[model samples]
Target: MKKLFILCVFLLAGCATQTPSKTPSACSEEQACTIGDQNTVETMQPLSFEEALSFFKEKKSGLLYFGFENCPWCQEALPILREEAKRQNVSIHSILTRDENNELLYTEEQKQEIIPYLQDYMSKNEEGELTLYVPLVVVVKDGKAIEGHVGTVDDHDAHARKMTEEEKQELQKKYEDMLAQLSS
Candidate 1:
């Protein structure tokens, strides 16, 4: 009985360990609010999955951005994302949820198929207005996925890995270039 009790304590300790926080300590409440309105900006007509998929196939070598309208980081990354996509000449898809604004993005046929994924693959909040925030980028060619993820955790872990000044500069340049392409 004593041995079993000690074993239970060890198991409990293992379960008690906390997941490392992925948010930066410097991320302020103000920044959180404006996360939707970032320094970088890019404009593009939103596309349906079918339209986006066709574009991806035509690009031959393309990047697919998987995200939703409600996620703040997804909004923050959009402009920078545009620059990078322009440089690489890839197609981007701002993902949609059936329960949210995605109503128009997908056909009635697709809702059942995608509903499960939107809820499971992305970080979902039951309350508040919904928006998908995970930053997912897939590089694909010839209908085959060349690089990307099939995992549940897709958001950037800048707090844990940390973003360097050099990386930020490079990202800024790329973002500017993408905006130019979209305008062109």
Candidate 2:
């Protein structure tokens, strides 16, 4: 009886000491092929363009980030975005701008279909054609894109290099500012 009690206590102690499991991330592929790196990839929930459209159609309020692993800017900004999202306790939905082969995920026709929904988030080029850029974060509320930010800081133009401390701070502030609007 004493041995049984000691065994039970040991088992209980072991269970108590074990770390609680974290919620499974929404990551799909073996890694975040679209976003890159397990850590950054795990922070976002991957959604199809159709799925994303449905959210907008349904007027669901959430954060949507568009980028792919191949995008240098995305590689640099995603980690920071993940950190900011965690700090704000927000979930981010991501879509792959390109496939593994670096091919565009959406056809021009498909893009045309969704252009109206995301027109505010996109920019027009010199040719006056709507262009969608990667590393774009859009805050959608009630089916309207209330706020959108593209790339990192204005000063850190190049994606090949890393952002300096000041740039990172500025970017964090930008993210915080953008995310703050979500609650409002």
Candidate 3:
């Protein structure tokens, strides 16, 4: 009986000593509010605009996704991005383009600071002012933007509706090609 008890204790100890899960942290409350219940992507790590810009100034390599939770386009692209990141074994550093109040995520100074690096991907608005659109996935290597893809697909013009499976697959392929550029 004593030997059996010792064996049971050993089994319990072995179970208790198991390593932590590799899953990424759960979405923040704000993220949840933005993303809602359809979120399947768990690899998103939120970072400040300053930190994302530092990757450029410091010449670091990373995948940076700029989007807000309310954006249907962003919500659609996230799962694809997550899968591609997992497949490539890379971490995605995300930057919120807007807050819960629908305000800009960064200050004017921050916008100015990062504009030069992101100008190529930004679009011009009615006033000829540059606008940064959501779901902009940028792969930077040594701080240089190697590849950047904005939105899910070129054919899908509406954000109010979900993309077709074919479109999602196309987006997945786009992400795969983009993430393939990661050197570090």
Candidate 4:
């Protein structure tokens, strides 16, 4: 009986110490991909609120993109934003709601700080529902938001339509003009 008790204790201890597996995947089964067969972007995952804040502080004149890995609009906008960032030579900071492990990355306090900005920029749908959608792009200067866009610029319908090169260039120019105004 003593031997069996000792075995049970050892098993329980091992179970207690076991950590969750870290698999390398874009999204889990619970978090279905909404990108519609497109590849997801490889973005930096901030481990803590401080890290994300520091990124914003360091890149004072940049774009802060809030998104989820499983969001379809986010997936569509990322590549366009990447190209825009390169063309404009501007920094782009990605803030994710959850990590690849489906874990919450932002703390309550951090959400409080960020969500208001996203909320302020949200638009209403045809049904008059206040849409707090993902792929939110905020143009920031000195850690303050100057402008915010809820969806892909030029994809007004949010239907994930394929944008032509001309359309992409026009969108990039629009943001560049906005950033220029903020700088001035």
Residue 39 CA displacement from its true place in model 1, Å:
23
Deviating ranges (above 4 Å) for candidate 1? 1-45, 52-61, 88-133, 149-184
**Candidate 1, pairs of clashing residues:** 70-131, 83-178
For candidate 3, the 10 contiguous residues with the lowest summed lDDT are 29-38
Q: For every candidate structure, what is the RMSD over all alpha carbons to the true structure, in angstroms?
A: 18.7, 5.7, 5.9, 12.7
* Of candidates 4 and 3, the better by TM-score: 3
lDDT of 2 by residue, 90-158 (tens): 778888778768998788887887788788878888999998887899899998888888888786765
lDDT measured at residue 183 in model 4 versus the true structure, 0 to 100: 44
Report how far residue 23 has shifted in candidate 1, in Å: 28
Q: TM-score each candidate.
A: 0.38, 0.76, 0.78, 0.54
Q: What overall lDDT, based on C-alpha atoms, would model 2 receive against the true structure?
A: 0.78
Candidate 3 residue pairs that clash: none
Each model's lDDT comes to 0.45, 0.78, 0.78, 0.59
As a whole number from 0 to 100, the lDDT of residue 181 in candidate 4 is 53
- How do the residues 101-145 of candidate 1 rate in per-residue lDDT, one tens digit apiece? 444545645544433333333344576423333555444455544
How are the candidates ranked when ordered by lDDT, highest leading?
Answer: 3, 2, 4, 1
Ranking by TM-score: 3, 2, 4, 1
Q: What does candidate 4's lDDT look like per residue over 1-184, in tens digits?
A: 9999999999999999976443222433233223211233323332244545665556566566667786666766666765555454555555666666657766657655554445578766699755546677777777667787766665444454666677666766666665455447
Candidate 4 has its poorest 10 consecutive residues by lDDT at: 29-38
